[model samples]
Target: MGVLNVTPDSFSDGGRYTDIDAAVQHGMCLFREGAHVIDVGGESTRPGAERVDAPTEIARVVPVIRSLFAEGVPVSVDTSRAAVAEAALEAGAVVINDVSGGLADPRMASVAAAAGCPWILMHWRGHSREMQKLALYSDVVAEVRDELRERADDAIAAGVDPSRIILDPGLGFAKLPEHNWALSAHLGELTGLGFPVLFAASRKTYLGRLLAGPDGTPRPVGGREAATLATSLLAVASGAWGVRVHDVSATADALAVWRATGSPKFLGTRTEDK
Candidate 1:
């Protein structure tokens, strides 16, 4: 998966692809780079970010999704609002990557059920503005697992098929750096929820902190590609069904290497052909 944030306030690469033409071109580039799916977001869900109205989000994502769908690329709308999801689906998006786990909007599950599309229900406590304050967890893994299970049940009850559902642990949403690391370390626990697990830790703050410098300053988003690739491979090894990423070519190459080596040990070494 390749991330396409159409919003101007996303933590990484926000304003870089807001225009429909530029966003479509970038989506094509990602497809050429080996991304199987393009996840498009109209709103910035970075911690403490303000929420954009449904119309604005629809305006941001629908045209780009329509253009990509016309070109035959599978697109997933990264929205928690039912209205945005409906409009994106109407515009030809095939999947809903809801970061709120259907909690933010009352009609999200029903809209997904009606569309009969694959829905990624991520573990989330609140919107970007209030999510960080809701990160308190006694056992992060256990809590995440239980919450996702309940979310799946809720979606099923709301008419979404169990097989069409995917689970995301909401790596950066509402999670502290430690919680994100813990989820990464124990990803198998979340994947055990019987749905395809989507690990989306691309250029997240946790990776930056993991690769911090001697002065303890976290690395910038562009500088975290190496660490992001490492974590992506790790997620795959841990039984993740899919990895949401920005640098899809590097990840695709890594996966090819892993398969060629018959899943050899991951020792943090470059496996690319020289």
Candidate 2:
């Protein structure tokens, strides 16, 4: 999956693709570069970012999704709102990548069930603006796994097809640097839940902190590409179903190398679901 933030305040790549034409071109470019899906998000879920109304988010993404759909691209609407997800699906999205794991909006599950598209339920505790305060976990890995299971259960109970469920260990939404690291190291725990797991650690703040300078200033977004690639490769090796990344070309090239080198696990776990 390639990250396409159509809002002006996403932590990374914000304001770069807010224009519909530019967003469409970028989506096509990412697809051409080997991204299986273009995840389009109109709202900025970066820490402390404010929420936008459903209408605003729909306006920002529908046209872009329509254009991408017209060009024969697979798109996922990265939203927590049912209305926005419904609009995007009507506009041509095939996936619902809800960061809130269907918790933010009570109607999200029904909409996803009705559309019959793949729904990615990310582990989230609260909205971005208040998430940091909720990052209190005794065992990050176990807790995240349990929480994701609950979210999945809720979705299933709400009539969403279990086969269409995908799980994401949201790296930064409500997690601290250590939590992200723990989750990254133990991603198998989440994958072990029998759901396809999406690892989206692309250009996240924890990576920046790991690459911080002597003065303790975190690395900027542009400089985190190498770290992002490393994390993505390791995630795949550790059993991630897919990775959401900012540098699609680089990630694709790295995966090619992984495949060429004859990693038995990589060879054995090719996704059976198209």
Candidate 3:
């Protein structure tokens, strides 16, 4: 997966692709760069970010999705609003990547169930404004695992097929840097939830901190490409079913190399050659 944030306030790459034509072209570029899925987000979910209304989000993403769908690229709408998800699906998105795990909007699960599309349920505490305060956890992994299990149950009860659900630990949503590290180190525990896991640590603050300079200044998003690729390969080796990243070509190449090593675990790894 490759991220295409169309919002002007997203933490990374904000305002870079807000233009519809540029965003669509960027999505195609990512597709050619070997992204299996193109994830388009209209709203910025960065911590403390303000919310964008449903109509605005729909307007921002629908055209991009339509263009990508027409090009035969698999697209996923990164939204928590049921209205936006429904509109994106109708506009030709094949998946719904909800960061709220259906907590922010009651209709989201119903929308996914109705569309029968793969739904990525990310572990979330609250909306952007208040989520940072809600990051307290005795055991981040255990709490996240339990919360995700509850969400999966809710999704199934709301008519979503259990098989169509994917769980994301939400590395930086409400987590401190250490919490994000812990989650990545113990991702196998989340994968044990019996659903495919989507690891989305692309250009996240945790990676920035890990690659900080000698003066302790965090690396910028563009400078953290190597760290991101390392994390992606680690996640795949640790049993992640998919990874969300910005530099999809590099990640695809790294995974290809790891797959060629012929580990008993990665026997069937494949790469997109475009």
lDDT of every predicted structure (CA atoms): 0.92, 0.95, 0.92
lDDT of 2 by residue, 39-96 (tens): 9999999999999998999999999999999999999999999999989999999999
Candidate 1: worst-modelled 10 consecutive residues by lDDT: 265-274
**Candidate 3: global Cα-lDDT?**
0.92
2 or 3, greater by lDDT: 2
Task: Please write out the lDDT profile of model 3 over residues 93-165, one tens digit for every residue.
Answer: 9999999999999999889999999999999999999988998999999999999999999999999999999
Candidate 1, residues 162-199: lDDT per residue as tens digits? 99999999998889999999999999898887889999
Q: Which pairs of residues collide in candidate 3?
A: none
Which is the leading candidate under TM-score?
2
Ranking by lDDT: 2, 3, 1
Q: Model 2 TM-score?
A: 0.96
Per model, state how many residue pairs clash: 0, 0, 0
The C-alpha TM-scores of every prediction are: 0.95, 0.96, 0.95
Model 2 clash pairs are none
RMSD, every candidate, angstroms: 3.4, 4.1, 4.4
User: By how many angstroms RMSD does model 2 differ from the true structure?
Assistant: 4.1
